[model samples]
Target chain A: MSNTFLIILFVLIGGGLFLSFLRLILGRKATDRAVALDTTTLITTGFLVLVAFLQGRSMLLDVALVYSVLSFLGVLAIARYLDGGLR
Target chain B: MSFMNILAHVVTGLGALVLFASGLGVFRMPDVFNKMHAGTKATTLGSVLFLFGLGLFEPSWLPKLFLIILFIVLTNPVSSHALARAAHNEPSEKPDNLIIDDLEESKGGDQ
Candidate 1:
């Protein structure tokens, strides 16, 4: 049962990541790509947590935590740059 | 499987599904603000649900999961807001659908 659940999860998340990447490539505007990038990072964070659970290694959760923080900062920086507010 | 195990599976599965929908929205939305709406709200909810489900599987990880959820909830809106403001400020990507853009008028007057 757990194995089946894991398979389903991997497929779903992989599909999501693929779609986000597609948007990043096909997006016409900078903000469109930025939104896609944000979604990709968030899904990746969830993927990391799922992997941590599968491995029984609590330490990987810390990595997921840090990744989320960094992604937030990245998005903020990107937004500032796009707004021309960053000098 | 036990009750908690089954519950975790359901919760986590739902989270993954929500995430997939968010991705679809990001890809399919016609405008940047619409994409941000989908990307930010659904991603935050989906990740929080996923983390909560994981915590159910390993009770010891609850505290850290809660911390992550809290941080995401707090920061996702701020980042998205920044992005939306930036998009609005950029003259190249002004939203085409708005009938009454109060911000533009105010900002225009101030300038």
Candidate 2:
């Protein structure tokens, strides 16, 4: 049953990631791409956490935690740069 | 599968479905603010739901899962807010279908 759930999740996240890529490619504004990138990082974090659950490794959750924090910083930096809020 | 396991499956599945819808919104939304609205809100909730589902499967992991979810909830809106402000000020990408330029008006400049 869990295996079936895993397969279903894989398909769902995969489709989401694909859509994010499409938006990133077709986006006219940098902010649109930023939003897409943010979504992609989120999906990746969820994927990492799922992998940790499947593999029975607690350390991978830490990786997901770090990845999320760093991605937030990345988005903030990009936003700051775009807004001329940075010196 | 037991009822508990079924519940986990249902919750996680819904989370993933929400993430997919967020991506679709990003692809189809007309402007930056709309896209940010869809992306941040849905994805934040979806990720929290996903973590909560996993915590249900293994009670031992619940604390850490909650921590992660809390961080996401706090940061997602903030980052989106910053990005929206930036997008509004961007010189090259004029927002299509913009209804109000309150920020522009407040700036009191022709920028």
Candidate 3:
């Protein structure tokens, strides 16, 4: 039953990811693309957590945590660059 | 197989649906700001729900899942706000529709 749940979870996340890719392709402007990418990263983090559960591994949580932090910092860096300064 | 596991799966499935809807909103919204609003807010909430469900399904990693949720709630808004401000600051080719220009007034010493 856990395996069945895992399969369904994977399918759902995969569908969400496919939709996000479509957004990246069809987005009209730079900000629109950035927003889509940001959403994608968040979904990826969730996907990783689900994978960790399916694999019965505690270590994957650490990876998910680090990815979450790094992605947030990356978005901030990009926003700063767009804003013309670190300030 | 257990009732609790089934409940967890249901929560995760709902979260994924929310994430998919947010993605569609990103593509369908009329403008950048609206897309940002939809994507950032909905995805963050959806992800938190997903992680929470995962934590319930895996009892050993509950602490880590809580930390992930904490990090998400804190960072998502900050980054989204920064992105929106950056987009707003970029000069557009067309004049924006405005009834009042407070920044312009302050610049001209019209206090």
For model 3, the superposed segments whose C-alpha errors exceed 4 Å read A2-4, B1-3, B93-111
Stretches of candidate 1 exceeding 4 Å from the true structure: none
Ordered by DockQ, highest first, the candidates read 1, 2, 3
> On residues B69-89, what C-alpha lDDT tens digit does candidate 2 reach at each position?
999999999999889889877
Each prediction's Cα lDDT score? 0.91, 0.86, 0.79
Give lDDT tens digits, candidate 1, residues B43-105. Answer: 989988888988898999999999999999999999999999999989997778987889999
Query: Which window of ten consecutive residues has the lowest lDDT sum in model 1 chain B?
Result: B92-101
Model 2 alpha-carbon miss at residue A48, Å: 0.6
lDDT of 3 at B83: 83
Say which candidate scores most in lDDT.
1
TM-score of 1: 0.95
Error of 2 at B99 (Å): 2.4
| Candidate 3 lDDT by residue in tens digits, B8-87 | 77877788778877777776777767778788888888987788877777777778788999989989999899888777
Evaluated at residue A27, the lDDT of candidate 1 is: 94
Native contact fraction, candidates in order: 0.84, 0.72, 0.73
For model 3, give the RMSD to the true fold: 3.1
